[model samples]
Target: MHHTARKFSLSVTAILASLLVTLSPHTFAAVGSLDLTTSGIGYFSLVLFVIAYLLVMGEELLHLRKSKPVLVAAGIIWMLLGWVYTQEGMPHEAEHAFRHTLLEFAELMLFLLVAMTYINAMDERNVFDALRAWMIRKGFNYKTLFWLTGFLAFFISPIADNLTTALLMCAVIMKVGGEDKKFINICCINVVVAANAGGAFSPFGDITTLMVWQAGIIPFQDFFALFIPSLVNFGVPAVIMSFFIENKKPDALDEAVEMKRGAMRILALFLLTIVTAVSCHTFLHLPPVLGMMTGLGYLQFFGFFLRKTLPGSLARKRAIAESRGDQAALRRLGDVVPFDVFSKIARSEWDTLLFFYGVVMCVGGLGFMGYLALMSEVLYTGMGATVTNIILGVVSAVIDNIPVMFAVLTMQPDMSTGDWLLITLTAGVGGSMLSIGSAAGVALMGQARGMYTFIGHLKWAPVIALGYAASIAVHLWINADLFVK
Candidate 1:
């Protein structure tokens, strides 16, 4: 079934590509050389982008990878720009645009790559499982567990990605809920909301916040200003939902799981890497990616040490065969384990990374084409700034916040620091309102499968909606000073 759907999607893409190429060559000219704001081509580019976006949003139904259409659209948009530049007899503009895109892509990609590598390495060492085991051993009641998982999701997501945090917490939910479907459903929503809300206050929390930080639009310290608001975002819904959770205790695990051989070490190293990244960004006045790459280096060195000391089965077997004395086993161990960094990298979420690639390029192409300027006019100028930003946040619940925030950044509307923070807050937490709104929410749905579906999440949308409004109101009321010129 999926195969057939993919084939159809490809066919559609091929048709679109053909249409793009078949367009009149004279449509762009060397004399005037069309810009993105040019009526026909600009509108066409926007339509193409919108179509690609819709396809991305319907990825599940279409059985298509969201990256495919966006990748195609990015290529077409750039080609259109290239044609315009070529016609204008000034191809340097296109070249410059390419350079700019490459610069941004490189930094963001490397940052994500290192972060993902650490996550993969931790997973390889069963770090998450060990944490889960510890949690289960506590044997907290369902109500306590619910609050615990939600609060953990909120606080932890600021450091770890929200999607991963959501999945981890959802595991706890399922383990505690057992066969109780309704309990599992509500807990999943709480986890999603907590994760999204928690992610709003830190630059490292959400992709949108990361973008804002990397863009130098918001200082790292300013992001912390959203903390109270984010807490309110999580708190409002949490308080309302708490009444429904029954005070049933969870079953205690019969056996506690031990951490893997180097799991604790790896976990410690991961924390160090985060600190290094933060220090570099805060003190060194460098891009955080630099710090992340440095962290990756630390992991590599530790991995090498582990390979020598903790070789895998094949090495141990080889050592056993060569062992004349007890020490012979240790000496021959270096050949087998091999410090598997490549494996960790290979296991990292390439799909999500590539999806990010397509998004950045598609949005960048739109910016190059002048659509963002129109967007600025329509969104910010036509409507009041605060209302527009708030609406965008709500829109982010349905559409991905990554692109919405990217578009706003590209438009570069003049607003106070507070306004930037507001947009960041909204974009970050807005996805909690819908299962499909945020990566964390969507991920929890999949992680919990039949027990926690989209419709199930929507049932609690009213509570989450209250959270959505409350968080914004708190931000407006408390953070109003920042918004003043």
Candidate 2:
């Protein structure tokens, strides 16, 4: 703890330096602020991301207390970088810049909110809450239940974020594994990896993918190209983990039907939310979040109506009913509606939001320094080849892929179908490297403590590592013709 205040001051200094560059756009030697064509801003932003990642990892590694000042200071660094550098006294575009930043944060928040909402909503139905009870009744041995639970998480994550998916699956996992800490840790590890890898391909699967789609970095159709590779992403990890996971027998199902009319109600709402989200994007040109917000609003309205229309006892009974309905199931979905769950979802450790804000502002800051814009021009000119573009896309996963993709998308270079596919695949799966690599992975660790330990994760990184590497190989090989052309 020596010179603790000094360390904080030093962190603040980096932000100020970045902010100064952002605020003074004219100072950029290249055209506009931060050389988009060729300069240091992108790399500088990478530096910031790394520092932030390290600090976060340190806190997690050491089990530090909640440090608001640390978070606040970091956020300031990111904000100033954008407000000062990117906007650069360009009063006319200030609104656009601010709006874009908000949109970015909202996109991040939307993922968390939706995941939280769905999981809590599911819990409300007494859905996953019955894992232990169901497992007990099944009479399956611990070993058999462990593998079954992992498989369940693996498949569920395509719809659920890895964290929520992992959490949902973990209820069964922990119950089956009992007090075997090592087995429990491995099971959680498998869930996290599967959920994250599964989430890589679809726009709705992961926030980064959603950002890419919504920002038009990759069109909707282009996203599905990762489908084959995403399977590999999940499959590879499952296979490796399976090698470690000895197979067990199946558990029996007991008659514990809490099914009521509310299950149908929940299903209806889930479908409605999905329908509205797609419709808004397809017809209204609304971003996913706006549509989700609309759906959430409607859910609330529906709840109010139910409270009024349904008589007291009948409503209570149905609301408490368990079922095969979606997590958005009304009545039993306690986790989503309860005040605490809602708050937790809304406030789910949004350091990354601030991190994104920092990246946006920091990238803008480089423009002020004549660093980013120039670099952009250079990259666009140099990496015009399809192969090169794919290479860059793969590299993007190592750092925050958002800025690179944004920069590339803005350049609006002539790229082909396959090259764009490569971008989607690489950027999507690249985050499997470390826990801090992806938002969902990080959130899963916090949400499921003891179950999915960070060190335990490092133990099994090879599973996902092979997945990531092999998927890229598959992407390259499958699209060989396009790359060659």
State which candidate has the highest lDDT.
Answer: 1
lDDT (0-100) at residue 217 of candidate 2? 42
The per-prediction CA RMSD against the true structure, in angstroms, equals 7.7, 9.0
CA lDDT of each candidate? 0.74, 0.53
Model 1 agreement with the true structure over 1-485: per-residue lDDT tens digits:
12222222222221211111111111111112344676677778889988988998788899998778888888897888788788889888776766667565766666766766766666656666667777888899988988999999999888766776777788777776788998999998999999888878886677777777766667678899999999999999999999999988877875455444677787788789878877887788787778878988999998888777754555556667666565644544443345587675554444455666676776777776767677788989999789999999999999888778777777777898889899999988888889999877766666678999989988889988888899889989998899997
lDDT of 1 at 137: 84
What RMSD does model 2 have? 9.0
State residue 436's C-alpha deviation in candidate 1, in Å. Answer: 0.6
Per-prediction TM-score to the true structure, in the order listed = 0.86, 0.68
**What is residue 79's positional error in candidate 2, in angstroms?**
8.8
| Pairs with backbone N, CA or C atoms under 3 Å apart (clashes), candidate 1 | 30-87, 36-369
